[model samples]
Target: MFDYQIKDNCLSNKNILITGAGDGIGRQAALTYAKLGATVILLGKTVKKLEAVYDEIMALGAPEPAIIPLDLKGATKQNYVDMAATIAEQVGQLDGALLNASMLGELNPFTQIHEQIWQDVMQVNVTSQFLLAQALIPTMLNAKNASLVFTSSGVGNKGRAFWGAYSISKFATEGMMQVIADEYDSSTLRCNAINPGATETKMRASAYPAEDKSKLASPEDIMPLYVYLMSDDSIGETGKTLKAQ
Candidate 1:
């Protein structure tokens, strides 16, 4: 349970960019990072949602957070490249980046997976993440020690039945993470993946409508691992999947 001290200023001079930060785990992570003294960049498709998150970070009197409204599902390489250039210009070098955005396509048998659903899920969950990481690599490498985390799932590590494109995308995500980690492990850039097991969030509710939510941990409860991974405490760590409480 939060092995680290979680110093009031753990992220004291860092800037962290989090995607899918409008809600769920991403939102919680943003708020936590802000409170811990990092300037947060909130990214999501919905401007209002990102605004709300920005307001929350501001209310805490933490750092002045920035909002980026862009849908990953339809984003292109140029879009990510432009975003990276802007971040480099504004924040200099990004100290941390969490690839928390994802799309849950039709969760059905592979044989029944819709063609559009497969493409859409891969766009957001895999392709977009790749492009974003590619764009931000330079910025991240510029940091003293930067951490890159990809949101992964249990089904990703092992192919499961009826999980369809979502699982496959996560698997790709994990592989992407390893590739980055292996290539940059000796450098300032470290890459890893997180499997926020059974967190209580809207996406989880949607995926498990019949299950009892009370049995799952809240997003807040899982921040310890997230915060740890984002900070210097885990500097030597890379190319592994972390499980959140």
Candidate 2:
């Protein structure tokens, strides 16, 4: 895990948005950020799951959370633009956004990869992120200091034999992060990518069903890096692909 001693109310008065906030690492991150005094915007496909997370955050007596149920697979650039506008109108100014939602298509050999599966994976993991980032950038820039964190994978940098589109999308994600980071090199809004190495999540379970999940890290275990990137502690860091292990 990335080592950082998180101070109480580190994210006080901050308005952060987290995609895929209903489950796994996203869910844990929402709770964690809320506990640290951030007003989290929970965006996910499942309304029930988002509500559950909202309840959890409220139970923690943290800032009141807002939920936005969006299916990234079918969401358009216009949808993202409108959503960002809504966020700006309601939240006033955005401080951070975690582009953590992704899809894992069928794992197969290079020659056997399905076109639809490839398209679906790319749509959710790459295109949606691209659109969302484009829409959110202006709002994020409104803050005195902001962070835009993209989720990458272990196969993001290295091409894996059976990872297929998932790997490719992550590679694109890293590239996208680098591009945005470089563009805003001297700006208050910093961009970066995080590769959560082999954590125990549903995506991990589906990818390696036979593996021993007990040996893997939990979502909570890798949260230090997530928190660090969003916090003021990482003010100057940008364009790097960090690993949370």
lDDT of all predictions: 0.92, 0.96
Clashing pairs in 1: none
C-alpha lDDT of residue 90 in model 1: 95
TM-scores, all models, native as reference: 0.98, 0.99
Query: What overall lDDT, based on C-alpha atoms, would model 2 receive against the true structure?
Result: 0.96
Error of 1 at 169 (Å): 0.8
- Stretches off by above 4 angstroms in model 2 are none
Question: In model 1, what lDDT does residue 3 have?
Answer: 54
What's the C-alpha lDDT at position 229 in model 2?
A: 96
**Clash count for each candidate, listed in order shown:** 0, 1
Residues 1-245 of candidate 2: C-alpha lDDT, one tens digit per residue: 78889889999999999999999999999999999999999999999999999999999999999999999999988899999999999987999999999999999998899999999999999999999999999999999999999999989999999899999999999999999999999999999999999999999999999999999999999999999999999999999999997
Please, what are the lDDT tens digits per residue for candidate 1 over residues 1-245? 44556767888889999999999999999999999999999999999999999889889999899998999988889999999999999989999999999988777878999999999999999999999999999999999999999999998899989998999999999999999999997899999999998888888888888989888899998898899998889989999998874
Count of backbone collisions within predicted model 2: 1
**Model 2 TM-score, all chains together:** 0.99
